[model samples]
Target chain A: MKALKALSTSVGSKYLVALTGLSLVGFLTAHLAGNLLILLGPEKFNGYGHALISNPLVIPAELGLIGLLLLHIFKALRHVLLGRTARPQAYTRKVWAGAPSRKSWGSTTMLVSGIILLVFLVSHIATLKFGADYPSAEPGVRDLYRLVVEVFHSPGIVAFYVVAMVVIGLHLRHGISSAFQSLGLMTPGWTASILAIGLWLSVILAGGFALIPVWVYLFL
Target chain B: MKVHLKVWRQTGPDATGRLVDYTAENIAPDMSFLEMLDSVNETLIARGEDPIAFDSDCREGICGTCGVMVDGRPHGPDSCTTVCQLHMRRYNDGDTIVIEPWQALAFPLIKDLVVDRGAFDTIIQAGGYTSVNTGGAPDANAILIPKTVADEAMDAAVCIGCGACVAACKNASAALFTSAKITQLSLLPQGQAEASTRVVEMVDAMDAAGFGGCSNEGECEAVCPKGISLKHIATMNREYRKAMFANR
Candidate 1:
């Protein structure tokens, strides 16, 4: 516990945030790629989804993913709260020096948007991954791809998912660069490369995930 | 070039302040911004008006003394340079320039375009130094700091205590300034003996002096005449964390 406290207090906490963020980035990419299987039509996509959830390794991975997400949110909230408490006066003047870096806006507002993302994630999983506790015509006949298409076909749900994907894109943009820096992988030349990679990864994940909803609403 | 200057005027520390407008005619484009101010002062002195009081010592960019909010930007429109080094060429003719002293609770207005930044000195005094004895200067090569470490320390050491970082910060945070000094000393082996003590005392002093906390904004680096990095702030946080646990 003392070690945990020490870890929490040190720059280690930043590492924790960075590592968890990277994990989420990886998860997003994998999730998006799997969802992209929907392009092959419902049978292949639903089979992939069934296989993923039924896999022996997935249960523990799911637990770990949950832990990682919670940890990231917890630490981010703590840091934001600590920073806020440390400075009571809101900025009223334009700073000419010592401005916050022009990194991704998502990274800066991660705490606020992370909460929104968390809510969206819960509702999304409850709707598709874990069926809502309501009686349906087909009870627990978990066809995730169909469920995804169905939910996205609704205008409100499509709008919500689109907004959530934007937030996710933002989160990944900052998180990618920040994660590399926190892990001590940032070199002068490598910094730009790493940031570029992070940007590409974010775009693909966000774009891919977002395309699913848009496709379902328009074409599918 | 002729320019109109709206300068903040406070007679003394206790007096209320107002902006006074003045015009300088036929100013040289190559003249440093301070030189233009000097020309205005010379004309004012000839007229027997108490020449608009301002602080400046080394006309050179170093020494960190010549600071003013020039036209809403610290050290004028130029990026990564001090006011004394800012030349008149950056502005066009007939420009209406607004100048003000550094405004912060910790930095009190002493007079027109001059704020008493003695709070910085006090904050430094609270801890900005290593407990080294005054003797013959140690051989530079004896330290053997890795080139990377030396480079990083030098980067942090470039902070001139100009309070530009504070002025540029929307929150008026001194974290960059404080962290730069803390990192400068804490990096070298010579300063290692007092590292833990130095970080704790300095951070406490900075907080006690009523400066805002850093929000990781990189504005300080942008306007810093020396281009000091905010990585030093991260270093300072690391040092402070170490001190808290190790000292305990």
Candidate 2:
């Protein structure tokens, strides 16, 4: 872990950023795949929820996820603050000054997107993760399926979720490939393809999350 | 050809600066960007005004000295060429050009278009060296370096330390500059002995100098006078990680 201790430096912190970001991407993928169970109706969704909480690994896995999220946030905040301190005097008139295809906008706005995501994450946890519980739809379980359906039913909450997803998407646009480059995973021949995939993944991942709320609100 | 210039002028590091307009008349198309500035400076001097103070050495572009933001692009609108080598032909006649010093908190303005890049020297002093003692030179072929490695090392070595990369970076990050030195030395067998300590020390120095971390934005590579690639930064990232992780 001495090596990891050294990673506490700015560049090393970047690797931590990439690692945590990738881990969160994994978390998102699994979360979405599991969320898909809601489409099978409340019984299956609630059953899935009960099964998840019943597993011995569930509590530890949740704790690990929280750790990853906290680490990601801490690193991001440190870098953002360092970035601001680096250029105390701002440019008077500015242009992005990079290739249009490989936009720097995403890179520059990461701090903003991160703040938005942090707010959204807090609201998400407060509203759904620890909000009021209904009587069991399944024996010896909270009616989490009713909660999901009820949560998405509100147009305002659905709208908030969609907007937050877009923010998350924007963060991922730069975060994905940047992480790879920071970790030295990029090669000249593969950079373009990797970036292209990163872009598509950003859109798909965010779009997938946004669709769930809308899908449940409308048809389910 | 003629051009209108809006140049940033400041009396000193703490003095207020502003973009003031000037005109260059009858400039030759073939003249380098710095040459046109020379004409403008000459006119200013003739009028008993202080000429713009900018840094330049080895007008051929290798010294890594002369640099300014012309129309928001570092070293003027030219790619892979320093301001001293950037031809006036890249601009149309009657074009308006805006020039500013490398604006970073870490680089305080000396006067006019020159800023003190002492932070770079500080970062260099932190580790940008191999500690071989003076002795008889080793045989040229004594240490075998693969052709690919020699080429790659040369690629990183091509960095002129112009500060253009930092100036052009949105966050004013010095990642490109720091990594260039890291990649250049860390690739060699002579440098390997101290790679671990060097990377950690250099990066700490860089951050302490108040330079931002690399976002891998590629802006620095695009405007680099020496065509230094982002790959060097990537390599540094890898090397830095290995140095840190392996230390444990």
Candidate 3:
């Protein structure tokens, strides 16, 4: 109870958000790695998917990810409320303090991008995880590779994934470095590198995931 | 030079405020921003109208007393300078400046361009000071603080508590101000005694004061009159984490 109370304070809650956010980043990296196996053909992809699904630890890991996602959303929503109440009156004409200031379109639009990603997350799980489960030639191993190719074959679904990946990119563009600052890991010497990491990580993950679908639609 | 102005006008705390237009003519380029306002107020007083109200004590930048949203940027566009130190030379002759008070629920409006910054005092009261008793003044070099450490502490110490950080923050958060106070004390030997309690209590006080959470966007550091770095914020976070674990 004491820990809960401490972590719930405005500053403390930020620690929670940063930790959970970065943990989710870790999850994305692994997910993206697994996703890239699609380029190696159906046999390799299906076997990898089967191994992951067969692992008893996968269920608990999925549960943990869900918990982290929900907590991140909860604390973020609370911040939105606090932000509203902090300034009952609004500025008449607010302008961005340019240069040396880190404020950006990505920083300001965090909440919007976050919400869009949340909606995409739901539809993504529905389409990929719970869609048709065809059995592979190897008994008991689901043909997950076929499902991915079929889904991406549709131009509409491919376009949706591309748009969703762009939103993810924008979200992480601000989120990665913001997480370090919140966790107190940032320093003047490392600030530039950390900022670069945020930008490049977002691009890599977004572009990498977006590539798989476009590749499958065009070549596979 | 002459300039047009749209300044926020409010009679009292509860009164609805609006941007009332005024013009200052024949102003010298070297006149400070406040001096231009002073000239405008002179015309209003001569016309038997209520002159605009603002706060200023020690027209020098060190006092942290004078500040206003000049053209939406805190303390005007100059970096590491206060509103009082900002000069009219930075503006074009016919430029229009819109001025507003530091708007935050924690800092209530007292007049047109002044808000009560007593919440900052409350945060200081919480734990911004060192409680250790030093027997009179010690020798100048007794503490033996490293030069780099002293310089960093002084950097954090330069925060004028002008509330520009809060005004510039999208969430109106006091994290930068609170962190600066925490960082200055935590870096010194005398400050070690209450370090843990200081961080925990001050952060709690900051939250109780109804300030918002930090978004780590660096706007606060940018608009700070003293250019207090956001590194102090990171230091504060580290201190808070250590304190929470240590106390538990």
- In terms of DockQ, the best-performing candidate is 3
Pick by lDDT: 2 or 3, better one: 3
- What is candidate 2's lDDT per residue for A1-220, written digit by digit as tens? 2666677877888888999999999889888888888889878787888888889998899899889989988998888777777777766666555553255556767889898898998999898879778878456887887888888999999999999998889999999988899898876787888898889989889999999999999997
Question: How do the predictions measure up, each by TM-score?
Answer: 0.74, 0.93, 0.98
Q: lDDT for each of the candidates?
A: 0.76, 0.85, 0.91
Expressed as tens digits, the lDDT of each residue in A131-174 for candidate 1 is: 53333234443566666667777999898898999888887777
Q: Which of the numbered candidates is closest to the native, going by highest TM-score?
A: 3
Name the TM-score of candidate 2: 0.93
What lDDT score goes with residue B12 in model 2?
94
Better of 2 and 3 by TM-score: 3
For model 1, what is the C-alpha lDDT against the true structure?
Answer: 0.76
Highest lDDT: give the candidate number: 3
Model 3 CAPRI rating: medium
Q: Tens-digit lDDT track for model 3 on B1-248?
A: 98999999999999999999888999999999999999999999999999899999999999888888988888999999999999999999899999999999999999999899999999999999987666888789878999998888899998889999999998999999999999999989879998988988998999999899999888988888899988888888888888878844
Error of 2 at B70 (Å): 1.1
